[model samples]
Target: MPLTDTDRGAMLSVIGASSVDDLFVDVPEAARLSGPIAGLPNHASELAVERHMTALARKNTVAGEVPFFLGCGAYRHHVPASVDHMIQRGEFLTAYTPYQPEIAQGTLQMLFEFQTQVARLLGTDVANASMYDGSTACWEAIGMARRITKRGKAILSSGLHPHYVSVAKTMAKYTGDALATSAPTLTAETDIDALIAAIDGDTSCVVVQYPDILGRIADLTPLADACHANKALLIAVVTEPVALGAIRSPGEMDADIVVGEGQSLGVGLQFGGPYVGLFGCKDKYVRQMPGRLCGETVDADGKRGFVLTLSTREQHIRREKATSNICTNSGLCALAFSIHMTLLGEKGLRDLAGLNHALAVQAAERLAQVPGVSLVNDAFFNEFTVTLPVEARPVVRTLAERGVLAGVSLGRLYPGEDALANGLVIAATETTTAEDIETLATALQEVLA
Candidate 1:
């Protein structure tokens, strides 16, 4: 049922447009290209293109080949083989959004379990099906906070990921809201007292990342209380949700909204894409929340069924009055997340989190023994920043050449930032073995020498 030329022509004709180019009449002529792109070949056979791309892909070294330690949002957590096996069981993988809940019983059930797990993990009352990714979830949280408080100002902490902050800024620009951001690139050990000072009456939400970029976990209960006193909402952004197993939930800290990336559950870091965005909030703000929510109901047969409740807030019915244009979301990814979480359950997840933290502590201890290196945060969960004698960029490149993935360099993420330029953020998951830690340490020592 692929689109045919006749169908395309008919659709264009129905719109009173002669060609596809006619639909772009409003586009600026300067922006419209006069010709095809120069460097690319005109066309190639399917097999030939596949072979070409395969050759190109083989040139790059994957994470599995090297002792991997890279983590700046995406970590190399060990997902059980069962997680993917269950997700690809045909019934779940092939299912779409539960638009018709009666027919989509499997998907609706998965969504129900996913929502429950997210709510429990975040210590929130309600969670939606899912969003695009962590960044978009943060964006939507700000919007939700604004709607609930009837305020337009947002206060973002410096410890938040720079990319997440940028996304929030872009969303603010579109809505014409006021945004006050702290200094960029703060580690987990950074001063939260300064961030609290930035909150004011007009501030609708105060956003902060848990176990922040430097892997320093913040006890945000005090900050949440301060936000509440100022009549501002607390939007907690968690780039790594697995950290929740060890740390306290944001909702327990009085967070009005808890949004995070759920890729660590079952989603692979497929080159920084296709991650599930976890979103949950206080029950009182469910109406203002974005994304679809599946609820349980009884049918005529007295059997439990799922239905799409509270969808009128979407763009289809309300048009410009819609709470959000995110009518659809990452269905399969969220299902994968739900399946993985179910397989782990509560105790299993807690054990996994403990392993990650223990491995990270071991890695930090070994790396600290190296000369000219200092561990920045003594208190951390699974990741932490290391201050090196020299800039970390060249050091990391040297290690990569030696068949070590190493960790993320602060200089690379924040180009001109001097304080962090010499630091490296390292992570250790259940997948990081002692051999990998040793390899990283040996290579780091060689590079520094």
Candidate 2:
């Protein structure tokens, strides 16, 4: 696939570069590699390539292979065998975007079901088809709030995931929107009071995370009331959707828009991505919500049918008028989520959630008793933070080397921020075992010692 000399010369000429190296003029010379990667061949046999890749893969200490406890946004959940089998069926697997509703009845209907389930799960009036992921969906919610409130300032709760906050700040810089951000403290308390006080006439929305990034749960009703009083919207972000099974939904708390990552359901962690984003909001803000929306209606012969009711994106409409500019989404992942939700149903989901909470409580209680560790949440569902006497980053690495995935350290989330250096966020789901919790505790205790 290498470009011909003519191709390379012609491309370089068009870009006003004399050679390929000229294209990298902006890169720092010290950072540039002097030669190809060591031990990596420029070319290799097909079998050799596959063998090398397999070797690299085997070196990874996968989540399931270890006593896993890692969780900040992504989670490790069990996916039913039937969920994968069904999605792999040719009819569902090969299908692309459902542009033609006539031929895409199955896809449309699945999306309709997905939307319904998400709406109910988040306690919102309507939910979109899907989005890129939680962070992008969050930024979209902020944009929607701006449109509705006619304001450019957004107050971001310190408890919000740092990655989500980073995404909002990046997008806001280009859109001329102002984002109010602050680093989270390593404490049991949330920053709801500060967020409420930050709401003002210029504030478009207040984004608060449920059971937040630190896995601390707090009531958002007062913050919601404060936003409403200032004509601003309250956008609640949920990173752990499974917690909804045991706690009140943001929509019920009067949050205007609710968004979250749906990876905890059927979408088992696939290294990092592709994860589905869940977005939902009140009926009044349906028009302003981004991404796709599927609606149910009867076709010609009095038969129930589904259609793409709203596709407010640049590709589907005028770029300037479209509600969102998101080019694509995780359709397959969304399908997996829907299938898993269907299999679990409402009662099953609640039961599974209970098991998760039970295991988490056991794990949290056990982990807290370890010397040099202290639990940092007054309330939580499946995930919570625990502070260590020493910086958690080294402890996490030491535990990993000992065949245990302890947890996510605040040092990793907020680099160079010394205040949160000792904070560690841990999540325990149904997959966690009594032995696994014990393993993490013993390993962590030894590492600290």
Candidate 3:
């Protein structure tokens, strides 16, 4: 696929660019490398490369190796050994698109189960196989709203993760969708109330994050009702699906679209990726759902069988009829998620959720007792915000040096927002231990003092 001289000239002509360097005009001059990367050779032996990578990897502090407490979207949970064992089987691991029903029954069946589990977990009439991740899934949902409502403007909740908002803004810039965005607030006003009042006749959708980035929870019934009244869709984003086991489901609250990250159940943090996005919605919008949907039917002999019910990607169907040009599931990650959920069952998930909340409460209480620290959330599930007397970013760095992987800092999430510079967002899960909580509390006190 490497471009020949003629091919390169043709591409440059099509884009109205003179040279390859012209394409990088948006990148800052100082930021771009002038020459070869320092200390990196143009060529190396396989053994040498392995050694170099190993040395670099050893410098990173693995979450499980220390007192870790970081969770904004990706989380650290106890993924069972059986989950890995099941996913690595040759037929499952090497599987791809299930186009041939006769030869791909196993893959189709697994996806069917995954879809069913996601629907019940998210409390929706139906759920797609999966999407890229939470952020893309969120953008897809907004696009779906525009298709369903025939409007151009989408109002984003202030509490929506800044990362997700950034992704939406990037997409809206090209698609001509009007995006109304704002920075996060530390005030008493709720995003739900603010967004409900912001809805208008031209609004296509309202996007809200459940147990939003700062880890505060709110009721969505009123907001959903308001969106319906305004002829706008209510899109709920959940960064932590584990919260659903304890809190009310967004679908139950009448959210038109419920999409979230499925990393908490069976997937590893994996240093940020290969995470699955769980997307579900009311039955009325199933046809517009992105990715793929697996369906069940009986054969001529009355034997149950599974098949791909729908695939709206332009690659699969005609371009004009497609809902999304780039829509594909994170198959391996979704399989891991499904295996984990099946193992947990219904009651087990609730019990695991309870343990997470209880541990989070204990950690929050202990952290709040630190000098010059105050709790920011009165209600949260497995995570909360704490305001420190000093800038939390530096304190977090110091804590890391001391072998305590403290939670994410709001300053890190909202880089230049002076209003939230001192706030830190911490998380807890079943993997969190009493000692880990105590270590963070004690380390935080000393660092602040």
lDDT of 1: 0.86
Per-residue CA lDDT of candidate 2, range 292-379, in tens? 8989999999999999898888989999999998866798998999999999999988999999999999999998889989998958
Can you write out model 3's per-residue Cα lDDT over 139-254, one digit (the tens) per residue?
99999999999999999998999999999999988779999988778753468878988999999999999988888888999999999999899999999988999999999999
Candidate 1, residues 1-449, lDDT tens digits: the string is 48999999999989999888997889999999888888888889999999999999998889777798899889877777888788877556743566666567777878888999999999999999899999999999999898889999988887788889889888888897788875444344665687688888888988998978888887898888889899999999899888889889999998999999999998888899888999999999998888888888899999988777766455547676678888678888898889888888899999999999999999999999999999888888899999999999999898888889889998987878887788899999988899999989988998888
- Candidate 3's TM-score reads 0.91
Residue 20 alpha-carbon offset, candidate 3, angstroms? 16
Q: List the global CA lDDT of all models.
A: 0.86, 0.91, 0.90
Task: Report the poorest 10 consecutive residues by lDDT, candidate 3.
Answer: 89-98
- Candidate 3 clashes between residue pairs 3 or more apart in a chain or in different chains: none
On a 0 to 100 scale, what is the lDDT of residue 275 in model 1?
Answer: 88
Q: Report the Cα lDDT for residue 438, model 3.
A: 93
Q: Per-candidate TM vs. native?
A: 0.92, 0.92, 0.91
